[model samples]
Target chain A: MKALLVAGEKSYLNEISYLLKDDQFRKSTKNMLLCYHSINKIIAKIPFRIYETFDCNEIGLFIGTSHGELETTKDFLKSIGIDKRARPFLFQHGLHNATLGFICQTLNHTGPAITVSNRFFSGEDAIDLAMDWLQLNKIKIAITVGYDSLPLGLENQVRGLYPQSTQLSTGSAAALVLANEEGVRKILNTNYSINLNNLFLERITYCRTSNARTGGSTSTHYYDSNAIEEIYNNLSRYPNHCSTMNLQKPNGTYSVINMAS
Target chain B: MIASTTPAVAVTGYGVVTPHGLGIDPLWSNLLKRQTCIANDTGTGIIDQDILEQLKYSLPKDDGESASCGREKSLLMALYAIQQSMLHAGWTSLNSDDGLIFATTTGYIASWENELLGFLSGSRREDSFQEAFRREPLGTMLADICNGLNFCGHNLLITTACSSSAQAIAIASDWIRLGKVKRCLVGGCETLSMLTSQGFDCFKLLTRELARPFDKKRSGINLAEGAAFICLENESTIVDRQRIQARILGGGIASDAYHMTAPHPEGLGIYNAMKIALNDASIDKSEIDFIHAHGTGSYHNDLSEGLAIQRLFGEHSPPVYSTKPIHGHTLAACGVIESIICIKTLTEQILPTNIGLKDRDEKLKINLPLEHESVALKKPIKFILKSSLGFGGSNAAIVLGGIS
Candidate 1:
C-alpha cells in the first residue's frame, strides 16, 4: 500500500481565516464551524485533478481530534443559562463529528466516514487507521485528517508544557490522501500504545525532563503537524528509519505512535 | 473475484444504566408496560442545576478525590455497566489482545463547565487547570474506563453525535472480524450536559411532553442520559455457544453530505446505510423481521426516517418500534442501548409497543406497532435491524439476529 501526503496545512488561531484560501468555502463554513473545516480547507488546497481521477463515492474520510473546537464549545457553554440559550448554529457545530460531515458535503464524497480521538496523539491514530483501511481496500482513496484548535483559556493552563507555543489562541490542522499504490514515503510498519504512568503527571506538575528540551506545544493537534512535517522532511533519508512520537495529554497518560522508519 | 463474507461476532453479554434503572430487566419491564420514563428539569440555571442535584441522589456517590473533578456520574454509570457485562460474559480479566471501543458525545462536560465558570468569573483557581486536564479530556475518560475494567489492549473513542455508540459496536465487530482483536467491549455512554440540553432547547428539538416517534402529535426528543456496554466475542474465539445472546450479522455507516443537522428529505443516507448493512450481511431485504429506528420524534427526523423505511421495505416491512419515549433520547448512548433492546426482542420474541403514539401519520407507509396487545410476535423473531442518524449527516445501521 502507498501513503501519499496530498495536502497539509496548519493555521494558528490568529491566522485561521487567511489559511482558508477559498472565500466561498470560508463564508459557508465560518460560523459554528470548528477543526474539521480547517482540515477541509487543507484538503481543498489539493489539486482538483487528483480528486477528479477518482469517483467521490469511492473515497472515505477519517478524522482524529483530541480536543475538538474548544473555543466554540466554550462559547456555546457560555451562552447556556436560565435566561439564555445557545444559538442554533453553535448547537449544530459543537459536535466533534460536525466537521467530518461538513468535509464530506464540501468534497461530495460519500464513502465511509469515521471520527476518532485518543487525546494528544490522535493524529498518529488517524494515519495508522488510514493505512489499515487502505490495506483492507475498504476505499480506493482515503482522506485522513488531524485537527484541533486551542481556545482562549486553554493556553494559560498548559503554558508551562508549551513554553515555545506562546499563543494561547492557537490551533493546527493537517490532511493527506492515501491509496494502495506508490507515494512519497512507504509505510513499512506502524505501532501505537498507551502508557499509564505518573511520569506524564509529573511532567505536568513539575515540568521535568531528563534530556535537552525539544521546544514544542502540548496540543495533540499541534503535534499532529509535527509528526507530518517530520515524515515529510525525512521522506528521503528515512526510507527505513524507525521513529516514535510520544505525546502526553493532561490526563496523565502517554500516547505513543511508532512509525517504523 | 469473489466477495468475502464478514465473520460473525457473538454478543455474549450486555448491560445498561438508563432512566428506567440498572440492568436489562428494569428497562425491559418498563418498555413492556409501554411506560414513559421522562424526567423533568425544572431547575433553571447555567448548568441545569436540578439534574445535577438529582444525579447526586440517583447515582452512587463517588468516594474521595475524584468526586470533586465533576461529571463522575457518567464514569460511574460506565463502570457499573462494564462490570455487569463482564459478569454476564463469565470473564474475569480481559486478555491483552482485547480492545475497548467507547462512544460518547459529551465526555465530562460538567467538569469543563466548572472550568468555564472559573474562566468567566476571573476566579480561576490554581488547580482548576489541572482539574480540567484530569477530568475533562476524552482520553482521561477512556483511560479511566480501561483501568476500571483492567483492560490494556487497543482502544478507540468515537464521538459521532447520536450515531456514536452504534458505530462503536460496528467497529468493534470489525476489529474481531479482521483479526485485529479476539474480543472487544463495545458501547456508548452519555451524561446530561448544559451544552446539549440547551442546544437542543435552542433548536426547539426537546419535547415539552413525552416524545412520541412517528406520531402525528409527536413533538420532539426528550434529552436523557445513560450508558450501555456489550461484550462481543468472535465466533471463532467463543468457547461455548450456549452463552450467546445474539449474533451480530453486519453493520454499515454512511454520510449524506446533505445538511448539517437535518437529514436528507429523501432519507438518502439512511437508505444507503441500511442497504449497505443488508449487503454486508449477505441477506435480502426480505430477511429483516423487525427494525429499531432512530426515530428522534422531530418533524423532519420522523418524516425522513419513515420515508426511508417505506422506500426500503415497502409492503414487506416488518414491525417497527421506537423506545426513546421509554428511555428518552440518550444521544451517543442510543446505539448500544437500542442494540441491546433488539437482542432482547430477539430472545423474548416480544416487541415493545410504540408508547405515546395517539395517532400515526397517514402519509408515512411504514408499519409502527402502537397497541401494547399487538406488540408481541406470534412467530419467533429471527433478525433485527437497528439504526441511528446523528448530526452532521452521519448515519449507521447494524443487523443482529438469533443464533444460527
Candidate 2:
C-alpha cells in the first residue's frame, strides 16, 4: 500500500447546515437543498489550491446513494397518479444522479461524474470508482460521496431487511476527496474493484489466523457511526501505521477502508 | 492526448432488443426503412402489462423464467442479448478473468412503484418489502445476471444518467486495453417506468407528440425502453478475426458542469469529447465517415450538438443522424443500441436516414440525411463517431471503424 491524499470528510447532514442556511436556500427546493447541502459539505473541505491547480474539467465526482431521493420520487409519483398535480421541482430533484449533477454545477467541475448504487456498499463503491479513476490518471482529483435518507415512503417495506436495532437515520452522508500520491506521505489503499464480500471474508480470516504485521504496527478499529467520518478522522491518528476499519452499514454491508503509511 | 500506437478493441458480437424487434436484423431493417416507432404508451402505469409488447406480436408461452414483467423486462432482454452475443462469439462460458459491465437508470423501479401503489391502496402483501428489497440495489441486477450466467468475474454497474451504458462500454474497452481483463461484456438495459415518464413530463423534456430531432419545431424526447449488449475483445484475445463486427479505436468522456439538465450553449463538453475521441483514435477530423448523434429531439440537445458538429467538421461534415425516433430514446441503453447501429452501418454499407426531421433547424448548421442511402463504396467505412449526452452534462464519444 502507498500513501494517498486525504482531502476531507463529512460525518453528518447537520454539519453541512453552514453551507445550506444561506440565501441560496430561498431559491432552491427541498430535495435540491438536501443534495446541495451534502455535496457542499465535502467539496468545501478540500484545499482551495487543489481546485485551483486542476482545471474544473479535470476533477471527477463519484456519488452513491442506496435509495436516492426516495421521498422525491414518491412525491412525484403520488402527485401524478393520485393528487393529479405534478410538481416539476420534485421530478427534477428525484433522479439518482441529481446530487452528482448539482455538485458538478456547484464547482463547475467538468470531469465525468458517476452515481452508483449497490444496496449497502454504495460508499465503498464510490471510493472504488474514485481510486480506479485516479490510478488510471482519468482525473487529478476525485470527490466521492455516499449519502442516503431513510426511505420515508417505503420505510415499512424495506425495514424488515435491516436488523430491528439498526439506526437508519434521515440525511446520513459521508464524503472523501481522494487524489493520487504524488508527493504526499500518507496513503489510502482501498483494495478496490474486487469482490467485496470475498475480500471481507479473506481479511477477517487473515486477521484471525495471522500474526504477521503489514507495517510496523497493525490495528483494527470499529466505529458505531457509518458516516465514514470516523475512518477519516482516525487515519491521521495512526501516522505511518497500517490500519483497517470495517464499517457495518445499517443495511448489512460492511465497508472496509484500509489505510497504510 | 493520443498515446502511442495501441491495440484496438474489437466488437466480436452484439445483441439488441429494441422496439423494432429482437435480433440486430430487425433493428437494422426498421432503421433502413426510416420508420418512426414512437406511439402513445398505452401500458405506462400498468404493472402486469408487458412493456415490450411493441417488440413482437406475442412472446413464447413456455419460456419459463424468460418471461418478463414490466420490471424484469430489462434483465430478461439483457440476458437474451448476452446469450446472443456470447453465442455469436462462440464462447461456452466466462470465468473469473472476464468482465461484465452494464448500465441502467431504472432497475426494478417499476416493481417498486407497483409495491408503493399497492401500499398506498392498502393492498400490500407481507412479502412486498422483501420483494422490493431484493430488487432495490442496482448491484443486485448485476448479481442476478452474474449468477444466472454463472460468471465469476469483475462486474460493475454504472448509472450516469442517459450516458450510463456508453460510459460502461468505454470503460470496458479501457479495461481490455489496460490488460485488466481478456474479454468484456459491455452494454445497457432499461425498462419503462411511470417515474421516468412522469418525471420527463414534469421536466417538459418529453414531447406530447412524436419526437422530431433537429426539426425547427422540435419539442422534446420520446421515452422508450430496451436492452443491448456487445462482446468486446482485444486483438490478442480475438479468436476468429472473421467475426469482428467493428473495432473500437478510441473513446473519451467529459462533463459540461454548465448545468444539470441543460447543456453548454457552445457545446464545449460535446466538442471536447469528440475532439478527444478523434485525438485518441489518432485520426484526423476528416476521416470520420458518419456521426450517430444523440439527437433526443430536445431543442437544447439538437442546438448544442449541431453547434458542436459545425465547430468540428466545419465545411466537410459527414452525414449526421439520430436513431431516437426509430427506437425512441432508450435512455441508458442508447449508447450500445446506437453503437450497434453504427456497427450495422459499417458492416452492411447502409446509412440510416434521420427520421422525424421534416424541416431542419436552419439556425443549426449541420447536414442531416432525411432519406436512407446505401454506402456501396469502393472501400469499407474506416471510421464512425458515436456521441451520447446525458442529463448531468456527461458527454461520451467513441470512434469505431471496420475491422479491416
Candidate 3:
C-alpha cells in the first residue's frame, strides 16, 4: 500500500509454498502472550488504535517484535475487569514474538509471521526476508518490528558498539510499516550485502540544546557548546575512556570512546 | 543428519579477541611462549573495586584495550580477522558471493546499555543505534554492531549462551553445504558486561582470582569477553593445498528438555549430541584424537561433562581439556574460538595443557591436559571434537576432521 518492495535473488522466504501465498520471515511467535492477563490488557487496549477497530483489508500487513515490555499493561487489564491467568499471558506473550501474535489474534490474515535472527540485522533482514517473500507475491503488506528488552548480555557490549542509544539500559525497539508496491518506496530491488568494510559509525555534534524531553550532556566539554571545530580537529581525544573497551570484563574500565560526540 | 557429511564448507579464516589476546599475531605469539592473555581493567563497565567492596571476588570489566579486554569497540579486529581469513581461504585472491555470518551472545549489549542509560539519565547525548536503523532495529547489545557492519544477507543471531558462536558457524557451514549460500563468514562477538558480572555474581558462580579449571583447587570461572570468526567454503571449490586444521567431522544439536540453567545432571542431552555428531561424521568416539570440552569451572557442568565423556568414550576417552581458566569463559565466542583452538592444535599436532589445572578433581578421573606437555603424534590426527553447552539445557557438539 505505502512501501514498494524489492528483494535480493536468494532468501529463505522467497520460495513459495503454494502458487497462491508468500512466506514472510519473522523473529518468532513461538510463545506469543503466554497467559491471559496480558490478553485482557490487549482486550482493554483494543479501543484506542484504529488497527484494532478496523476490519483490516487496507493495511495489508502488520508485524510486531515482542509482546511484553516493562509495564505488563497491568493497569489496563484491571480496568477491563478480567482475570489474570495462573501464568501471566502478558509474560508469555511478553516473549519475542508476542506483538505479531497480537495482530494475528485480532486481524485474520491467513499468512504467516516467521521469526528469524542471526544477530544485529534482525530488523533489516526481517524486512529483506519479507521483501523476498513479496517478490514471490507472498503478501501485500509488510510491517516489521526489531525490538529487544534488556537481555543478560546487553549491558556489557554497549561500551564498544552502541554507546549512545541505551536509555536506562532498556532494550531497543524499531518497527517499520512496509507494503509490496509496484509504484511506491521500493523495499526490494536494493542489493543488500553484509560487508565488514562498510561499517558505519555515527558522530553526534550537539546544536544549541535546551531541555527537551531528556536533559543535556553532564560531561561539560562535549556539552551543548556551539563549536564544530573542537570535534572536527579531534583537538583532544576523548577524555573518559573508562567504559569503552573490554566492557564485558568485571570492572573493565570504560574507555574515552564513550558518549562520543 | 541435518548436516552433509564431508561438508562443502571450507574454514577460510578466523578472528579472535580474547584475554589470550586479540588478532592472530598476539594470539599465535602467546601460544608459542605459552603465556596467558589475562589482565585487569579498572575503567567502567564493572566497578571492580565497588563489586569487590560488596561481593567477595572482583568482577571483570570491559577493558577493550587490555589483553583481558580484547573484545570491545575494536571493529578493526573484526575487519582484520575477516581479511586474514579471506586471504588464507584464498578468498582475497578470488571474489565470491560468500555471506558473512556474524554471531555473538553478548553482541554489543554492554556498550549499548550504558550509553543509552547515560542518555536516559540525562547524562549524555546521542542516539546511535536508534538513529542507524530507525526504520528497522539493531543489536541485542547496547552498541549496534550489526547495523554498523551493514550485513545484508540472511543475517542471523544465535544466542544460546556459550553455544552461540558455534551454532552460528554450524549454520554457516550448513548454508554452504546445502548450497543455500556460496561462502560464509562465521564467528561471534562478546564484550564484558557489568550486568553479566552482577548476574553471575548473583548466581555466585565466579572465582576470586583468575579461573582455575579442571583443578582440584578450581574454584569458579573467570568470565572473559571478545569475538572470533572463520571463513568457510565448499571443498569442491577449494583445492587441498593449505593443511587442514581439523576436519569438521559432524555437528549435532539437541535440547536437554531439563532445566533452564542447569544441565540434565545426568548428561542426557549432551551425550546424544556427541553421539549424533560422531554418527553424522560417520566416525566413532574412539576415532576422536582429542576433545575440546566446555569445562566452565562450575560444579555441575564439569561433573556433567565428565560423565558425558565417560559415557561416550568408556575406557578409551581421548585427552580433554577446557581452556576456560586460561582465557576466562568467553561466553558465546567460545564456540568458534574453541573450534579455532581445536584447529590450531590439530594443525600443530599439540594438545594444549589446561593452563590452571594443577591437580584434578577427586571424583572426576577423566583425561585432561593438565600440564604443558606436548604429545608427539606419529601421524596427523583426523578428528577433533568440540562441544558447547549453553543455558536452557541446549547442547551442541561439532566434530572437525580431514587432517592430512
Candidate 4:
C-alpha cells in the first residue's frame, strides 16, 4: 500500500504568534496552540468542497514529540512550589495527549488517535504509524504532526549536552495530510491532480541498524521538531530518483526510511 | 473491521508490580477478597520501600557500573515487571526480531521535578544543570530494555494519558496480526509524584477518601504508582499451547473530539470504541461475559462510562467492575494492570468485585457486583472486554478470550 501526501503546513517560532490570533486558537494551551495552528493552516489550504466530502470517523490523528508540553509542566511545577497551589488549566493541558484532544475536537475526528515518542525519531515514527494505519485499512486519511517547544533555559541545557548539534534550539511544528489510494480516488477524483502540487505517492520501507558503525557512516543526523518536513523537502528535491534518508542518534541506533517513486 | 481470517494474537505471560505486592499472586488474592490497598494517610496506593529495595538487589549485575547508579523509579519498576514477564514466558532471552513498547504519562517527572526545584531554590544549581545535560531521552528507557534483552525489532513509547498502555497493547496486537513481528512485549510504568498529585488536586479530581466507583456519593480518584507488562505472541509462534493465558481477539481506539479534560456527557466516543472493538473481534455483544470498566471514581468519568455501557449492552449487560479502588488509579499503567487482572479472571474463572461500591447510582442502571461478592462462574468464561478512557477523550477497548 502507498500513502500520498496531499497537503502540508509548518510554523516556526516567529510565525506561531501570528497564527494564534484566530478565535479558535485563543483557548488552546501552549503546546496545543503550536499544533492546532499548523493543522488549521493545512485545512485552510485544502479546497473547502473537497474537505467537506471527508468523513470525520475515517480520519486519524497521530502526533509525535520529544518533551511534550515542557513549558506547561515547568510552569505548573513552579507554581506548586511558589504559590502552594497548582493551576488547574496548566495541569490539564500539560499532558502529552492534550494536544491530540484539542486538534480532534476542532476537526471533529473520531478515528484512532495516539501520541508517540522516540526522541529525535519521533517525527518519522508518527509518519510511519500513519502509513501503517492507511496500509491496514484502519483509516482513509491520516493527519501526521510533529511538534516540540523548548523553553529558553532547557534549550541552553540541551545545547550544552550536544554542542555539535544545531537543530535543538527553537520550537516548531509541521503537519501532513496523507490519503490512501482509495481515499484519493474517491474524495479527490482520479483527475484531481490538477489542483494539488507536490503530490508524491510513494511506498515506504523502514529499516533499523543497531550498530551505526557498521552502516558505512553515511547517516544524516537531524533532530529538529520539523524533522519530517526536512525529510520531505530532501525527497521532493530529487523527485525523479528514488532516495533514502537515515536518521541517526548519538547512540549507535538509527532508522532508515527508503522512499521509492 | 478485522476479518475472521486474521491471525490470532495470544497472551503468553504477564507480570505486574503494584502496591498490593510484587508479582500477580498477591494482587489476585487481594482483589478476590475485595480489599483496597489505598493507604489511609496518603489516600494513595504506594509500593513499600522494602519491596523496592528487594527489587533493586535483584537486578542483573552484568550491565556493569551503570546498573548500580540511581535509576528512576519508573525504570526500576518496569525492569522488575519485564523480568518477571520474560521469566514467565520461559524465555531466557528475546529474539533479535522481538519488539518492545513502553507507555507512560509522566516519564521521569519525579526526577525532573527534583532537579528543577533544587535549581529554583538556589541550592545545587550547578549540579542540576549538569544533570539536565546528562538526561537521556524518554526512548532511552525502551532502548535500555531492548539492549538488555537482545530485542532489536521495533520499539515505541506511547503517552496518551490514562489509556496509554491500552493503545500500546492494541498496536502490538496489530503488529502481530499483520506479520510485522512474531512476539512483542508491551507494558506501562508510572510513578506517583507531586506533579500528578497536586495537578489533580487543583482540579478537585483527587479524593481524600477511598475511591468509590459507581457509588451514588462517589468522591474523586486516588492517585497511585505501579507498573505492569504482558508478553504477546503470534499463535503460530507458540510451541507449548499450555503456556497461553488468553487470546487477544481484537482491539479498537476512538477519540471523543469533545473535550480535553472531560468526557462527552453522553459517552458517544466510548460507545463507538466498544462497538468498534466488538466488530473488530468479529463477535456479537452477547459473546462477552463481563466488562472491566475504566472506573476512576470521579463523578464525570463514572457516569459517562456507565452510561456508555448501558447504551452498548442495553439491559442484557453482563457484570461490570472496576479494580481501581484496589490499586488506586495507576494512571497510564492502569490499563495494563487491569488487563492482567482480566487475564487471571479468565484463566481462574473468578470474577472480582468492585471494592468500594456501597449504594449504586440508579442513573447508571448497569449491573455491578456488590462489595465482597466476588463470583466464580459455574460455566467457563469465554470472552471478556476491557475498556479504558483517558484525559484527552482517548477511548480504547480490547477483547480477550479464554484459551479453550
Top TM-score prediction, candidate number? 4
Give the chain B TM-score for each candidate: 0.91, 0.90, 0.82, 0.96
TM-score of chain A in every predicted structure: 0.63, 0.72, 0.35, 0.82
Record all residue pairs in model 4 with backbone atoms less than 3 Å apart, i.e. clashing. Answer: none
- Clashing residue pairs, backbone N/CA/C < 3 A, model 1: A240-A261, A241-A261, A242-A261
Task: List where candidate 3 sits over 4 angstroms from the true fold.
Answer: A1-261, B2-7, B40-74, B93-96, B119-151, B243-245, B372-379
Please give, for residues B242-319, the per-residue lDDT of candidate 2 as tens digits. 989898888778878887778899787888888878877788988898899999999999899889999999845888
lDDT per residue, candidate 3, B1-404, as tens digits?
34334454556566565554445556656655666555544211222333223221111233232213233353434444454565556554323345665554434445544444444445645555443222112233312333334333444555556666766665566566555557777777666754355445545567666566666776666777656778777767766647333456566655454544567776766776787678766787778888889998777787788888888887457888776655667777778878887777766676666777777776666777666656567666678888887654556788887546
How far residue B215's Cα lies from its native spot in candidate 2, in Å, is 1.5
Question: What is the DockQ for all candidates, taken in turn?
Answer: 0.41, 0.41, 0.05, 0.64
Q: What is the C-alpha RMSD, rounded to one decimal, of candidate 1?
A: 7.0
TM values, all candidates: 0.84, 0.85, 0.58, 0.94
Worst 10 residues of 1 chain B by lDDT: B42-51
Worst 10 residues of 2 chain A by lDDT: A197-206
**Model 4 ranges with Cα > 4 A deviation:** A21-24, A48-51, A189-225, A250-253, B64-66, B372-378
Error of 3 at A105 (Å): 25
Q: In candidate 1, which residue ranges exceed 4 Å CA deviation?
A: A1-15, A19-52, A55-57, A82-85, A158-169, A181-221, A224-261, B1-6, B40-71, B123-133, B372-378
State each model's CA lDDT, in order.
0.69, 0.70, 0.48, 0.79
The numbered model that scores best in DockQ is 4
Candidate number that wins on lDDT, 1 or 3: 1
Docking class of 4: medium
Instruction: Report lDDT (Cα) of residue A232, candidate 2.
Output: 47
The candidate 4 chain A region of ten consecutive residues with least summed lDDT is: A213-222
